[model samples]
Target: MKAAEPPVPGLRQPGERPAPGPADGVSVPGVATPSSTGSTPSPAGAGIRGKRNAGALLPYLLIAPAFVAIAAVFVWPLIKTVIMSFQDVGRRELWTGDPAPWVGFEQFTNILGDGEFWDVVWRTLLFMVACVVATMGIGLFLAQAMQRMTNWVRLALTGALVAAWSLPLLVATSIFRWFADSDYGVVNMVLTKYLGLDFRGHNWWLDPKQGFLMIGAVVVWGAIPFVAITLYAALTQVPKELEEAAALDGAGAAGVFRYVTWPVIKPVFQMVATLSVIWDFNVFGQVFLMRGNKPEPEYNLLGLYSYEKAFESNSFSQGAAISLITVLLLSGVAVYYLRQLLKIGEVE
Candidate 1:
């Protein structure tokens, strides 16, 4: 090629530089354009600078009042009770606004060694067990029957149960006391007139054994509603397909329940029994309303015992000790049942 004939006038050879100031219509690098005006900040970059914590801790801060309320009402009293259980105070010290005496474990020892305390313990245990068993048994039967009924019948039964549950404990106690009253109660009338039995009803509240039985009966009546509702909910959850499958296999109603329903509901039964035990152990209203101030021959339970020790006998330390024992018993029951409830669903 002609040794590179000079490039054309306005065009340069390949890779050659443009002319001095400008190429075609474009300006040279030395030239400058006007800077942009009225431009906004980048949305993403602006967001980073304007970001705040969004008050992440505001929810917990709002709930602080509730936590304080619970601690002030429940936790503080529980702590005070525990502390008082260990101290000793004479009647004068307890009543005359004097300081409590520090007796350490003496109150605990006294409670353990006391005959009446032990008797109350025995009675409490017996009553709790009996009430729990009777409540659960009747509750289960009623729950099963109600679960199989029409919606109308089920609603009626539920309404009745709710009525029983909603009845004030005092009201129930009054009604039952009137019914069992030896003088003019309807219960004795029915037994004497309708049944025509030789057994003339005596003063149920006057005897401790009879009082315990009456209290248990009243408690069972009130408690069955709760236990029955709990079991009914559990029964409703039993797999309908499994029940149908059992029926298809020529299994009778009892057989199907025994094999399929019982297994599924067994855990619920344990839960109800444990809860009822705790409730029965803490029963004070029924016994207190029926039998007051009397000891072995009339009323015996930890609650009544504590009340008598503190108010009747002026043994504040002993009362606190008994109350603490009751607390421990209830706590143990709660822990046991919590563990059971945790393991309940794992079986299936």
Candidate 2:
């Protein structure tokens, strides 16, 4: 065979491959070129580095002021309240600028041992239950109804819900109080005129049960909007095909809801129910306002009892102790709900 021509330097022969350089790119047939987009750091790297640094620091910077404010506004007072709960803080210590005498757990002991405190606890719990049940019941009903409404009707209903939910606590309290007014109230006017139940000049607050019933009505009214809106949103997540399939499988409305609907919205329902419990358990404003900012002993919830102990009776230590107990009770409630949620999650 004739001698093959010597392969030319710096030029690739036919079917010849180029060599890779030690640097970050492949050498071409005639030249080597460095890669700009390789792993090697570049000027752009400084920008990326800066961005990463900023990304790490930005959250801290944004939250720093909020953390300081919370520490000042809430944490500091909470600490002081905790300290006061262990001491003998009263009007004497408050006004005299003197150190509060340490009573250790005496304040807690006094509060726990009081028969009236138990009464307040039972009453508060019962009211909380009533409001939560009514709120959840009506809210679920409204949400179920919304699914059957026309778009315009649903929109109008949603607007109304928003209006109800947007009412300030003070405004709602005032409205309910006006409704329950003894003489000129609309509720009494309607009952006496239409139903002729002889509710003229009746004081709902005279009986604790009746007073709590009215208070619960106000609480449930305000709360239903939130629960309904939330559950309505949750209900939107349910698969239409699944519901249709369930319906086709000889399931009725209740069966479809129980099998297809409930599982989907159960988490949101649980969350709303728990929130209602917390909100109703700590109810203060409606009760306080309905009774003209001077709720009697019969209407005393934990909040009212604590206020009565601390400010009204000038027993700051006792009030702080009661407040602490309320916190513990709420904590227990939260834990119980959490466990239930977890259990349901496992079961489902």
Candidate 3:
């Protein structure tokens, strides 16, 4: 080897490999080195792993606060209500420190046996259906009309909708009551003066049909803004390219909506409709205010009926039972929304 090239310092000798530098990764005996294994740096791989773990936990972290709040505000109360529903609670039991005596299923049994409860149930369902139909129909019409509006007009319309939606339930109920009040109401005055139908002193609540019509009108008016705003937003997101293509294919307005728009907005539509059903099914304020708080037996919806039973009639257990039944009845809608949420989660 020619005397090993005079053993040059910091240089490779004959048949002797140069050692790895720190940048290339110095190998420890009997240990796996990153360079030797042709793998990334441990810290880099560890950083990626940490990021993945964080991403996995992010959704739960975001929901944790809300879950805690709902548990305290709704879940605890719900559990207490369930417990109360089984007890024969009254003034004595409520005022006393002692627990109320158990009535088992007696409260539920009595309410089930009462024909008036069934009538209230039927009436609630009817009102909910009518309100949902009218709300959805008018809201959908308004949303569709908005798509064709000029930018300024759309902005003005959106502002109006927001203002309407911002109104408190009591305020909206009061406005509707004033509009349809039996004495000196705008509706009566207008009908008497302009239409000449002589509806000056009509008592709407005398006929349940007419009373529900007015109540349903108020509900629809309040509900429309939310639905219209949601649908309009959904409509805006629909692919203009697809709509144009459908039009080019000789599709009419209805056909374009059926083929291109409906699929895009169906989930939103279903959610809004379900919400309307829940709200109108448990409607109390509008009915209560419209009938001046002393709602007749015929004027009671599920919520008002429950309140009347609990406070006015002092049938606490029965009211609790009715409330529980109401929850059970609407459980289907809850399940539907839950599935929708899960489906959305899966998509994400």
Clash count per candidate = 0, 0, 0
Quick one: ranking by lDDT, best first? 2, 3, 1
**Global lDDT of model 2:** 0.90
Tell me the tens digit of each residue's lDDT in model 1 across 217-335.
88999999999999999999899999999999999999999999999888888888888988989998887775542445347688988888887888777888899899887888899
TM-score of 2: 0.83
lDDT of 3 by residue, 215-289 (tens): 998888888999999999888989999999999999998999999999988877888887888888888888888
**TM-score for each candidate, following the candidate numbering:** 0.80, 0.83, 0.83
Give stretches of model 3 more than 4 Å off.
1-13, 16-65, 344-348
lDDT of 1 at 123: 82
lDDT (Cα, tens digit) per residue for candidate 2, span 1-348: 999898778998888776566353555555535553455668899899999999999999999999999999999988888999999987888999999889899998888898999999999999999889999999999998999999999999999999999999899988888898888888899999999799999988789888888898889999999999999998999999999999999999999999999998888788789989999999998889888889999999999999999998999999999998998899977987897678767866
Q: Roughly what TM-score does model 1 have, to 2 decimal places?
A: 0.80
Model 2, residue 229: C-alpha shift (Å): 0.5
